[model samples]
Target: MSFTVLLEFQLKDGVENAPEILREVLAQTGAFAGNEGLEVLIDDDDASKLIVVEKWASVDARNAYVAWRATPEGRTVSAS
Candidate 1:
């Protein structure tokens, strides 16, 4: 079965381009193995609040992705 992951982020004031940055970061996420799809949701009353809905092929796939994200290579991609 498929798995879903929700990630919430609260941006500080003055970060008007946060969505654009998220798009750039999500490019890598979308290309990762076993990633099915994803969607970005913004709070109706709070633009600074964002939620990322990620779909994976399976729970194991999502776990593997999370593990990879903890590695140096994954950290580099996120830190960029």
Candidate 2:
């Protein structure tokens, strides 16, 4: 079965560089193996809130990606 990951992020006030950070993180996410697609959605009522919808080929693939995100390199990418 396909796997979907929903991530939510709340930006700090007046964070002007959020767009660049989002682009970079999403770019890295898209290049990950087994990724079907990743969509970034902005809340209609809240500008500071963002939702990331990620689709993977399978639950295993999603789990693997989650595991990788705990590693040093993955943490670096995530922090970027």
lDDT of 1 at 68: 84
Which residue pairs does candidate 2 place in steric collision? none
Model 2 per-residue lDDT tens digits across residues 6-79: 99989877767777777877887888888999998999999889999999998888878878878887763323
How accurate locally is residue 76 in candidate 1, as Cα lDDT from 0 to 100? Answer: 32
The per-model lDDT (C-alpha) reads: 0.82, 0.82
TM-score of each: 0.80, 0.81
Per-model RMSD to reference:
2.5, 2.2
Question: Across residues 1-50, which tens digit of lDDT does each residue of candidate 1 receive?
Answer: 98789999887777666657777768878998899999989999997788
Off by over 4 Å in 1: 15-17, 76-80
Give the Cα RMSD of candidate 1: 2.5
